[model samples]
Target: MKQLFVLATALLLAVSCSQNKAPKTLVLYYSQTNTTKAVAEEIANALGADLEAILPVVPYDGDMGATAARCAKDAAEGKLPELKPFTVDVAAYDVIFLGYPIWMGTYAPPVAAALEAVNLDGKKVVPFCTFGSGGLDTSVKDLQAKLPNTEILPGYGVRTARIDAAKAEVDYFLKSNGFLAGEVTPLPDFSEVRPATEADAAIFDAAVGTYPMIHAAATEVASRAVPGGIEYLFTAKDLPRDPAVEIPDHFIKVYVLAEDGKEPVFTQVLR
Candidate 1:
């Protein structure tokens, strides 16, 4: 009887241990100018996960133009900067939250280096980024191509101009995605796309006109109601602008948020 009792207790303990084992998460990021670092730290804190920075052996610390030039040159030469040895055993973690700032419409070169050095096979990777305009979709595509074995989960991104909104957005994002323990009222679907009215065009212009990189004319718009205001999705044609500032894409979609009693500002641009 005593032996049977001991076996039952062992089984109970095993069940308890299995129930308590949480999936481990690590936030690995490479940040230039600290925008992406802030987002990484926020996710790490909110999730209570481990955080580590991916560093390049030769830093890109030059002025904006010089750094961009260097990045272009290195990319053209098919060179990836050497990465510092990662202290964390990546295989030990079940999930990796990869973060970086968008440069040249994709993940920074240092992050590219890190991906080459670390093998995250079969792990769930959540990408989070900070960008000047938008590169989340493009970088995620690149990541999918690079790490075909890893499960690439849907990611979160915040514009550099709207970094202040990231805290609340991240919280909502975590809860909405089932990453955190909370209830979120899911946002309603956007209204169907229709021709942009004069007023809609005005809002679109107000939102994106000041931005130097984007020279677009809104052709169609769709709106949805949010807690504080209306969110617009604009299907825009790439305006004929100076070839210097134009991107190769002909059509782009822009998301604009017009909060109550505030001016409209663009959130993200999808090309």
Candidate 2:
């Protein structure tokens, strides 16, 4: 009886401990406009994670032109602007979701500043980006190089102005990347390939200079071939190359619209 009682007590203690353990997640974002903030909130809500805002010591002007100027200046200087004081016990979370707007075609320097402030060694860093229309613009690659110690995954990017329409896209992106689970409705037939302007053509050419695959002929570029008539390519090369903007080698991605509606039937990295 005494032995049995001890065994039962041990089992009960193990069950209680298991039930009390919580999943660790953290959502951190830097937003000048609330678009990134809203998207970040949705992710945090979905993950039930702790939320932290990366604020600069000096706030940025929301005006597009002024903001562009400021971002350009910073990027040119490679300056790490001072950030408002904040803290995260990095060891506590197993995963961290980072969100930011694509400023000057790359991540806002303030995002880099926030990253510098924290140590992400051994942590999982998942990045989500918001842009006016330029999309991720090499922010993911840049972050990977910057935070070499962290185990980072491929990230999701959304147009800041169209985030409301991107809700399903956001949900699908997070899930496909393993941040969330369950049946994911793929992205819709959302891509529309339009005529490329001279500048657009030039950007594609420039991106190839940075990413050699961009200029490769369809046969030469070896990835899952996106079938014609089923794919859409959105090209934007009017991406300004100003010092204020931290634009990296921004390129385009091609995706096939899935029949299930809003789900990408296929996806490819163009550059």
Predictions: Cα RMSD each? 2.5, 8.4
Candidates' TM-scores?
A: 0.93, 0.65
Residue 11 in candidate 1, Cα distance off native in Å: 4.8
Residue clash pairs of candidate 1: none
**Would you list the C-alpha lDDT of every candidate in the order shown?**
0.92, 0.67
Per-residue alpha-carbon lDDT of candidate 2 for residues 208-269, written as tens digits (9 for 90 to 100):
33432233211111122222223335343324445577555554553222332233322324
Candidate 1 lDDT over 178-257, as tens digits, reads: 88999999999999999999999999999996798888889999999999999999999887677667566588999999
List runs of model 1 lying over 4 Å from the truth.
1-16, 242-249
Question: Model 1, residue 243: displacement in angstroms?
Answer: 11
Candidate 2 stretches greater than 4 Å from native: 1-22, 135-137, 185-271
Error of 1 at 35 (Å): 0.5
* Root mean square deviation (Cα) for candidate 1: 2.5
